[model samples]
Target: MRTQVAIIGSGPSGLLLGQLLATVGIETILLDRVSPEYILGRIRAGVLEDGAVRLLDQAGAGARLHAEGLIHDGFSLAFSGQDHRIDLHGLTGGKRVTVYGQTEVTRDLMAGRAQSGALSIYEAEAVTLHDFDRDAPYVTYQKDGQTHRIDCDFIAGCDGFHGVSRKSVPETALRTFEKIYPFGWLGLLAEVAPVSPELIYAHHPRGFALCSMRSMTRSRYYIQCSVDETVDAWSDERFWDELRRRLPAHHAEALRTAPSFEKSIAPLRSFVTEPMRFGRLFLVGDAAHIVPPTGAKGLNLAASDVHYLFEGLREQYRDGSGAGLEAYSAKALARIWKAERFSWWMTSVLHRFPTMGDFDQRMQEAELAYLAQSQAASTALAENYVGLPF
Candidate 1:
């Protein structure tokens, strides 16, 4: 089989790219190692930046999102027994974020792709890229006890961190930078109303905690835990107690607890791979970068990467110009680094470092105090939270 682009990994990044490319009549075949059910079963962060929301609309997948997703004008930063509202809408001149689960986004995109009559190969085993460095790149994979090959003009490596996309490149050609945090987030999802209407990032003497949601009736909460902590060690009662301790008294009083249906512990890390493009192969989303969820930039970062790469691909097919493709890596990385800095800064300010002394603790407090009183600092946070220009 032959196509204009062969996309590996049918996650949101891959699916979104495929949908957008299809808008311009670009032929793309999506290959994934797992079934669609397994893909949607994986829970993830939900905060959607305005730019990301717009991209979904451009891809014809924003209808359900705009209808069911919660719109938040701002989120609260709770510290020192007080909640400070950032007023995202006011600070960013009326820009806001949408609180929609990543699962829903994927579902909508998948449905849109199906409706468009595009091709998606699920449970494709041993998927491999070939000759991406040469002019005629292709992909091969196993299915139904047979090996198949697909010739393509370009390959998109949206297969994520552990996938073959990044590993396909020679180590000598890649430079990687990573920082693994000392703590992980123990997150819980329960069927209950959220403690606050807007999300809350709380810093307390014990640890860092966040009050978030997937919908008005469904609450998602998290608290910092040791890197070595096990999910099995946390029961519903214990998790609720710890979370209540970390929140302010008023919110604590209003908090509603229920049996959690989903629970997990995810280690925090900041990782980025330089030069997202390799010959005819371009790495998008988790394939190129990862950030701590503190600033809620992970999914949005992936969307922006899609935006840049799609533009390049569109220009390549529409106008027969290679300039946009040539500039993809440099341009994507510029915005990526700024997001990395913000995520790192937010993580640093909120979480308690293992080695933090008295002075370090006071500095964290001082930072929040100044941010609450300073409009400039608040605006900066709001701009990053709502997302920077794509």
Candidate 2:
């Protein structure tokens, strides 16, 4: 097989890139180690920044999103037994976020790709990249006991953190920075009306709790837990009881309890790999960096990375120029670090640490108090929440 670009992983990032590239007459082949059904089944963050929304529109997959996605102008911060709203749209000069599930986004991208007659190979085994450092790069994978190779001008590593693309880089050339939080988020998805019109981030003596929704009737909630905790230990009743205790009185009163259809615990971490590019191979999304979900920057960050990579590739193909491609790593990282900082800051302020001392707890309270009172502080929070520009 031969193509202009060979994309590893058929997730949103990969599919979005392929769609954008195809619009410009660039041919791409997508390879995935898992089935398409499995990819669509994975649950992930839903918040979309304005930049992400525009990118989806550009990729021709924004129709359903615009139709069904809930627009959030603000979110509440619950602390000191009260809820304080952060006017995201007001503070960010009328910018707002869209609440649309990542699963739905992937589904839309898959459909778009199908309509465009793009080639996607799922259930590919032993996928590998070769000769990325040379003028030509190729990808190899196995299926049905036969090996197949795709020769392409470039390779896109849209695979996630555990993917082979990043690991393919020599350790000596890669510089990594990571911080693993001591706690994890125990999330539950229930088919019940949300407790609030918008999402709420609650800070209580017990821990941090979040009330979020995928739609008017499908709610997603999370409570902070020990890193060592298991989902099996948290029953629906216990989860509901614990969540209620963390919420303010009014919200707690309005909360509706139901059996969760999906329950899981996800650990928090901030990870970034330097120089997202290695010769002809460029890392995008989780392959290059990861942020804690506190600021809801995970998917947004991935979209931004896709934007940068797509722009670079488009410039290279259109004008026969390499400047955009050459600067891809530096430009993407500049925006990435800002998001990491915001996610880290939000996580530190909202979550309770087991090792936090009395002084630390007091400081956390003081920070929240200041944010609640100061318009400048609130604006900063709102700006980050709506997302920084791509």
Candidate 3:
């Protein structure tokens, strides 16, 4: 097989890139190690920054999102047994966020690619990249007991953190930075109406709790848990009872309890690999960096990486210039570091640490109190939440 680009994953990042590239007459072949059904079944964060929403639109996958996605102009912060609203629209000059599941976004992008007649190979085994530093780069994979090779001008390493893409790069050429939090988030998906019209982030003596939803009737909630905790230990009744204790009185009273259809625990971490590029192989999304979900920047950061990469490839093919391709790493990292800082800051102020001393707990209280009272502090939060510009 021969193509202009070979994408090493069929996730949202790869599919979105293929959709955008196809619109400009660039041919791409996508390869993934998992089935499509498995990809769509994975649950993930739903919050969409303005920049990500626009990129989906550009990829021709925004129709359903605009139709059914919930729009939120503000969210509440709970501390001191009260709720304080951060007016994102008012503070960010009318910018807002959309609540649309990441699975739905992937489905839409897949449909768009199907309509355009793009090629994607699933269940590809042992995928490998060759000669990425030379003028010709090719990808090889095994399928159906046969070997297949794709010769392409460029390779996109959108295969995520544990995938083969990043591991393919030599350690000497990569510099990594990471921080793993001591706690994890115990999340639940329930078939009940949300407790509030918008998301509420709570800071309580017990821990941090969040009330969020996928739609008007499908709610998703989370509470900070020990890193060593298991989902099997949390029963439905116990989960609801613990959640209620962390919320304010009014919200606790309004909360509706139901059996959760899905339950899981995710550890928080901030990781980044410098440069994001190795010769003609460009790392996009989780392959290059990861952020804690506190600020809801995971998917949005991936979309921004796609935007930077697509522009570089487009410029290279259109004007026969390598300037955009050459600048891809520095540009993507500049925006990525800012998001890393925001997610880290939000996590610090909202969650209780097991090792925190009296002084540390008091500092967290002082920071939240200042944020609640100062308009400038609130605006900064709103601006970062709605997302920094692309």
Best by lDDT: 1
Candidate 1 CA-lDDT value: 0.96
RMSD of each: 0.5, 0.6, 0.6
CA error at residue 224 for candidate 3, angstroms: 0.2
Decreasing lDDT order of the candidates: 1, 3, 2
Candidate 2 weakest lDDT stretch, 10 residues = 381-390
Runs of candidate 2 exceeding 4 Å displacement: none
Per-candidate TM-scores read: 0.99, 0.99, 0.99
> How much lDDT does candidate 3 score?
0.95
Candidate 2, residue 321: the lDDT equals: 93
lDDT of 1 by residue, 22-61 (tens): 9999999999999999999999999999999999999999
Per-model lDDT: 0.96, 0.95, 0.95
Q: Name every residue pair that clashes in candidate 1.
A: none
RMSD of 1: 0.5
